[model samples]
Target: NAMEGRVEIFMRNEWGTICDTLWDSKDGNVVCRSLGYEGFTGVPRYNSFYGKGSGRIWLQNSSCNVDETSIQNCIKSGIWVHQCNHSNEAGVKCVPIRLVNGSSIDEGRVEVYQYNQWSTICGQNCSDSEAQVLCHSLGFGRAMNINATAFFGEGNGDILIQNVNCKGTESSLLDCGKDDVTVQNCSHHYDVGVKCSSVRLVNDTHEWEGLVEMYDGGAWKGLCAQNWNTAEARVACRSLGFDGSTAVTQPFKMNQRIKAKFPTYFDCRGHERNLFECSHHRIPVKTGWYSNDECTQAEVRCIPVRLSGGYSNKEGRVEVFMNNVWGTICDAGWDSVDTRIVCNTLFGYSYGGTKVSAGHFAQGVGDILLANVSCTGSESNVLECKHSLMTDHCTHSKDVAVKCYQNIRLNDGKLEVYVKNEWGTVCTYGWDDADAKVACRSLGLPRYYDLKDNKKLP
Candidate 1:
């Protein structure tokens, strides 16, 4: 019953509809404001945009000044003064939409408001031209891509708009051509999505370090540094394809005249993938934190690290990615301390693990970048340890490998292994009861099975 369409009014214990002969924004504003909206800035429609209503045509030739509180108080001819039909039913748009559940503000599934509820748009027959118009309306430069299969994520609630067609230059999506109000034949799986290039880090030469700039409403704005912390920096760094944030710097002085367009305080746990994923507090202009001397632009630095050539994210042939090249580390003096640093860098936590040599996991083919490596167990990254830049003594056969304990799991009482991010049963070949006992002890569980029973466990 909340779907878009014809305007209807209830009076004298009977339902009646309004005629479109004299309907406009003034009358529509009165209807929307009476329904608890702040003001109606949306367009008024004729020819039953929401579908024709079946009832008495009560109001006709109605006119309302913009200051009217309700449609009943508006200047109108006597009730049912002229002949009319359901084809002349009136409709109004009271609310608009914005994107959500995306990795950035510029990407996500499309959602619109109707009947006091948020709804998704079906991607069926949605085109790139329409997406371009939508991006422009949201203060974006243009749409880079349009995903029609709910690529970001499936949405909930009603499917509002469908069969949208645009010429790629419209100011708003409401001005686009669409199918008449009818039951949609699509589901949430076919929800529409758009990716826009609207955010960037500026004022720095490095890709990982810069002042944040974002587009909002209809203008580009900068953020304030009242409560900016490392956790918030981590999200920004991760959004730029870094492992995490190492530091948050406030070097630029605050400009009180420059309005802060984003949340003032961000509460992140250092694991969110995007800035919007964190809880935030909007700072009013009158707040004490908005003072000219207190405001400053925030900048961040991120650690550039990644794991490669291992079956699982936890256990990998140690590789350092820098300057856009993937290179391996020599196994010379590789030990638990060095492996611990790698695990900490990858998983954001330490897991004391075993180190393997002679290409135990697999040989890596690249520059034997580092050799004679030594770590103090307190190093945050492998590169922080003492190591040689290049070595000829070690080959791909001596490439370093790690089997972190965090990558193993027990499923249904069976010792399962995870490699390359996939879970599978561990091979029992050459495995003895001593190995099983150590595994059980690591998990803080009693050893209940012998070596002969290991094969049956899986």
Candidate 2:
């Protein structure tokens, strides 16, 4: 069973015999690879494990030289076989698949919204850096939990394919995808998972305003390991525009690996231009007894933060301070529904209809945290808003700020259709009738209008 195979393969609704011409171990490798196997364990020979099938075409003559993707491409056309119906199913069996050097989903790894499905990391070109980030996201410390097989456990259900192409500069494993320019296969293993911990790093600020020291630099320092608390973490988080610190890491657990720039100690609030613009203070060793190694190795806790642009309503304007500049909210596209949510968030909207309104309600252009906010009538704040595009020549001065006009009732059911620059009400008046006929038939609703004319008025 090492050089000859007597199996009838189906192709082009015909059955044929595969000659031994151009058959060798290299061709065998192509077949195995196409079938999701690592490589050819042995060549097809006499008494080899052959596949039997009931289909359109059977017994294919194959010639393989390159990394063929499917078995159909490996073989040539063969004789016509009897058509196969569902009553008879094609069956094929081979030696048990063994796990090799690869990555697989762990026993209890659950993706965010991907449900309970598990996948294997494609083996085309997986690197140790990707392994490190993936391990950390899964709650493992660093790349200490790298595995070459489905060691954690075999995944159930459909085998998902995750092609990870790391350039070594990606901050996280998920950022990588199957790039079209260069294609590779990670089908070496059927299932893959990762084991991770929360061993992450924490840095000082976002933008590097001046001569701020980096992680290993001895000049700047962090809080001593002496009984760090959530309050300290909260303060540090707020300083960096974060909602609060999610977790605090103790000594011996911090990531001090200086390999990659990020996986560095601070994920900034916004995509900052530099690293020192954030607000957390750094400990400068002016005259204190400190060494470079001492500063880098000292037990400093990390404050993982949930971040956002901070905004609050004052008087009648939504105000936010960023980059040390305080600015007001613009209401260029603000409306009652948008303001209703804002009122509920800022002040309880128990007064109902009279609590929030929007009109001449524009705030002087402040630092534009955001602009051109399109509300589907379900959002809370402009900071949390999303727009179609950045808009043309958008300066912070052209940014609209919002402040809810007092006394407004929330309107839900009625659709707010845009017709002009100012939101004019489409009165229920003349909402019926010939008006619709003029609009519809004017635009070619002849069939609909003809049907109405063919019948009498009900």
Candidate 3:
């Protein structure tokens, strides 16, 4: 009564109806808007969708332009009509369809409103074209798959429509060509469902590594890690616009408590545009797999990290981009071994560099990512280093820094120095080849052959 069908008006203190001669969604939209509903699409009903009214027919052959505000302003003669009867009563749905029982907003079973009740669409003869329209109408890109056998789960009430033939270009499912409403001949077990490519990574600050959630059948459901592997993770990373997943970890802890549903196990060949394209077991049957538990949560980590705020390209304050934002690392227990991994990964320097602290270069602006970082000096990246989870106890004043010696060079045979990110000649006041040899060795160059007086060199 509030959201679906039956256009009625009050006249002479009695409820009346309108004629269905020219009723449509455009006309229904005005009524729905008048009732204070947004994003409303009106479905025209011919045979008194609400019920047969007992009073005079107040409007007949009502025509409304899209911009018109009210049905009262849609009469042909701008006057109430008494020429129509209750038999020709018109009805309209303010909000006709919705996705229900799914994991996310863009996914769910297709439900349509008719006869003042919600009904499911039969999976019989349902196709991608029909699903495309449904997904697009729900503000999703397109339909990833049309599940015919109630993949999301069965629905209650009547099977409203069957054999829906959509051209894939329609705005709504009602716009698609379909059989008459009276020809309902399908069962609830054959209820139609849709899966959209609206995927998200939750819990972790990094975009790549987190609990994987997919929008399906009307809600956000977690993906199970039963058969999840690096191949599947790679596909997920590629889907999210990354090169590929570096690691596929299972049972990753979620920051917030969640009642995860739909334990889907993916079987991927390492290449698929979306997760749904990968063959999957909708409900995994692994031992100890719980449908409503977080233990089955699967996570993936994509490789994305950088060194910033250093004097040279080889070294600086370490920052990682995750959850669509950049953040720095804390120096709580930072050391040379931890800084070595970052220097090796970015600068290709075999020897480990020195660890600087207290924002040696300058303070970073955002989050202090890692605290108590500890590496074995053999890791390829700083992410491989063991570190405490970021906490508010650390601040930018304790931001970690590194000074890599990879950029040191001699300029014009002079004992030039490169520190604090600049090039200048060493004072040479204390002058000896032993000091020169040590400097040359630090620069990874051959030992100095001779030490000449500064006047002789000049």
Candidate 4:
């Protein structure tokens, strides 16, 4: 074979070697022409054959794009068997068929290709949470529906898993498994089918969490905490082109918070490109406050982030309901308490000390809009700014964006945090005692102040 994978060849007549240089799709065409094979798949790599012969005539090379006759011309001195056995033969593998359909197969469900075959797995231990993960892995949004007991009719393939430890929202199927084990305690009666969901952009809210999809790549940004009004918030939301936002909330301490994540504010013009491509600014802080009631109108921006877009690498959409518009929040106020709201809203879990920010630290955009924007500890919307504007040469044009955590999954089974637009895997190795005390205190949990894990220094 001439091109695609790496290989060496020697001609039977000259015992000389030649290396394939012209490797391309054209080479693949030649392969099909000489082989009389229909439908060109693509060039695969890896030595297809290992040549073994006497002195130097170890192998023969030909352009993959050549016809059988052209290949014959390359070796006029002698004719080698078309399928001769050798140790140094060029090798290539046909690519596996990629299933374009976005759907999930459950514990027992099975489907047959053109080939009439059948196989099934036991759904005895499959849970909806686990099913959510499996479905998402299949290029679908979270699983919206699940059917079991041969729902799709039994088909074939090894019952690959059993007693799966699925967490429903896992990023991948392998994450739930124990090392190399597969097909755990499964039975023939378990068959499952999943309904894949589509991705949709969402804004942040007190009761709900929004996902971050894209990043602007700079300092962690902050939102305008000045005497903002709902009108400005709406403009910002519209500027970022978010469908709309829920009640704006004042950012509190997120237990799993990381410092300097996300932009201050987002500016979407509804007609602009996605959020990542839209223009954004920062919210300046002064005198422990954003802007005073001196300004009436301010501009904001947004980015279109996909929540369940089948791109695990992509962050979820995480926006804060700042002003009336949905703006990105900086990780400025992120602390254990703030992360508590995120975990509770997204994972339906009881608050675990906001685990370490197990996600990327989105560069911050600006400082918090207000140093002490008064909140009843639960006020939504950062506009209740009573503090005076802290900046000098700032205007609505310099409004900062906000960042949020759409969803985060942590090491403690359900511990999670948001940083930038991405979710991070928390580090358990270096977590120490002082951090624990800070975390516990942030959660309003009585400081254990005694346990080894909760030890305090000085």
Q: Where's the lowest-lDDT run of ten residues in candidate 3? A: 242-251
Predicted structure 1: clash tally: 7
Q: Decide which is better by lDDT, 1 or 4.
A: 1
Please write out the lDDT profile of model 4 over residues 1-458, one tens digit for every residue. Answer: 33233333435445432222122223334444444433322332212223333334232334433343233334422444332233323333222111122222112242211122222335665667866665454333444445566665654465654555775556555577532234555544565554433222234542222322222121112333333344434333332323333323122333232223222344444332223223333332221222332321222323222122112422232333333233333333344444344334333333442323313323323332332233332422233323333344433232322123244433454345657865566566877667655555444454545445656444
Clashes per candidate, residues 3 or more apart or on different chains: 7, 58, 13, 105
What is the per-residue lDDT of model 2 for residues 249-298, given as tens digits with 9 covering 90 to 100? 22433433221121123324432222322222222222132223332322
* lDDT per residue as tens, model 1, 357-414: 4455767885778888899978767877899887577788888887567655566667
Candidate 2: where are CA atoms >4 Å away?
1-234, 241-313, 319-330, 341-366, 376-381, 388-458
TM-score of every candidate: 0.40, 0.23, 0.32, 0.23
Superposed model 3: Cα runs more than 4 Å off: 1-300, 310-313, 320-326, 345-352, 356-360, 378-394, 403-458
lDDT of 4 at 196: 37
All models: lDDT?
0.66, 0.36, 0.66, 0.36
- Candidate 3 local lDDT, 1-458, one digit each (tens): 58666788776777767876556556777887777664355545554657777767777767777788878788864345654556556777665676677754446788886777777888888887898788765535556667888877899867768889999888678889987374456778888898655466775344556777765434566766668787887777655544342223233454444456544567888766556456653332222454335555666655445667766666677776554445788888776667667766655555536666655677889677778878887765676778777978978887877766764455566656656876667776887767866776565444456644334210
> Model 2's lDDT to the true fold?
0.36
Instruction: Quote the lDDT for 44 in model 1.
Output: 55
